[model samples]
Target: MLKGKTALVTGSTSGIGLDMAEALAREGANIMLNGLGDATEIEATRAGLEKRTGVKVSFMGANLMKADACADLVAATQKEFGTLDILINNAGMQFVSPIEEFPVEKWDAIMALNLSAPFHTIRAALPAMKDAGWGRIINTGSAHSLVASPFKSAYVAAKHGLAGLTKTVALEAAEHGITCNTICPGYVSTELVDAQIADTAKARGMTEKEVIQKVILEAQPTREFVTVEQISGLAVFLCSDAAASMTGVILPIDGGWTAH
Candidate 1:
């Protein structure tokens, strides 16, 4: 459905971002992946996706922590693809700490990646989207975007800010044949979440499974981590013609995490 479309997915070297890229590519969209990873591995990934999907696939390890770099990322993709049909703001970093104990640097880092990076990319990409008269802006929010979690003040705050940003943009672009939405997901078993499990176990003084059950999955009624493919599939749907009327939507795939 995305044939001839060009999509730039930030933080796509691994995990959900990677899955998002692959899913879009499978739908015939040209992919421009951005994130951090070993040089050779990223290249191999880039090459392999191109071969498998028979679509042009490129990679740039833009440091999304910087606002200017985010603009440069959008510019580079525009230069390569001639148009930016879909923008996936999936780049993010997490730091777990109580508000008082949270390091100032960590707070800045989380806010920069989780919140500010999307702002930069969206601002830069909007004019083009407006000119094209069609665009899809998908922000990767989390359950934290809707609810709070203890000792995760920075993450929660940034995600909440992101939700507001997504809604605002959607309203502004509602008449432009452009749609903006945030996908709020529950915990997914990615490397980032895996590392957090250990930290949470130590912090909560519980075993890994206990942390998984009592901590991570505590509020999730399904007791199951969301799948990367599931998110990617939803992303595809949002970019489809069927979703033309859906904008400013905070669609959650949280396994009922916010039901309470």
Candidate 2:
């Protein structure tokens, strides 16, 4: 459905970002992936996706905490694909600690990556999208965006800021045929979450199963992690013509975590 278009997905070397990239590529969109990973591994992923989807795939690693790097990443995508039709700001970091005890540096890093990076990328990419008269901007937010979680002050604040940013961008770009929205997901099962579960289990003197059931999935009403494929599928739909009017929406795929 997206043949001849191009998408730039940040933090796409693995996990949810990689899944989104693959989904767009499978729909025939050329992909430019950005993230941190083993150089060899990233190349293998890039090559494999390109081969399987029969669409152009490329990778560019950027430290998104830096404003210049975020801008440069967008520029690189435009230069590579000649036009960037889709921009997915899926890069983010988390630091969990009491607000009083949170490291200043950690808070800054989270805000930079989770909030400011999208601003920089969208600023760089919007003109081209405006000129072309079409664009889709998707920001991967968390349930924390609409609610709160203890020991996650920085992450929560950044995500809330991202939600506001998405709405502002949507309003500004509405006349240019550009749509901006945030996808807020609940706890997702990924390598990072698995590692967290193990650490939490050890720290709290609980079994892994207990950690998964009580500590991790406690607040999620469905008691299940949101799947990467499900989030990717929603993203694909948001980019489709049928969703042309769905802008500035903070759609949650959080298994009812935010419904409370």
Tell me the TM-score of each prediction against the true structure.
Answer: 0.98, 0.96
- Write model 1 residue lDDT over 116-185, tens digit each, in one string: 9999999999999999999999999999999998888889999999999999999999999999999999
Tens digits of per-residue lDDT for model 2 on 1-260?
99999999999999999999999999999999999989999999999999999999999999999989999999999998899999999998876556787799999888899999999999999999999999999999989889987667888899999999999999999999999999999989987678767755665688999989997789799999999999999999999999999999999999988888
Error of 2 at 257 (Å): 1.0
Off by over 4 Å in 2: 198-208
List clash counts for every candidate, in order. Answer: 0, 0
Model 1 regions more than 4 Å off: none
CA lDDT of each candidate?
0.94, 0.92
Q: Candidate 2 clashing pairs?
A: none
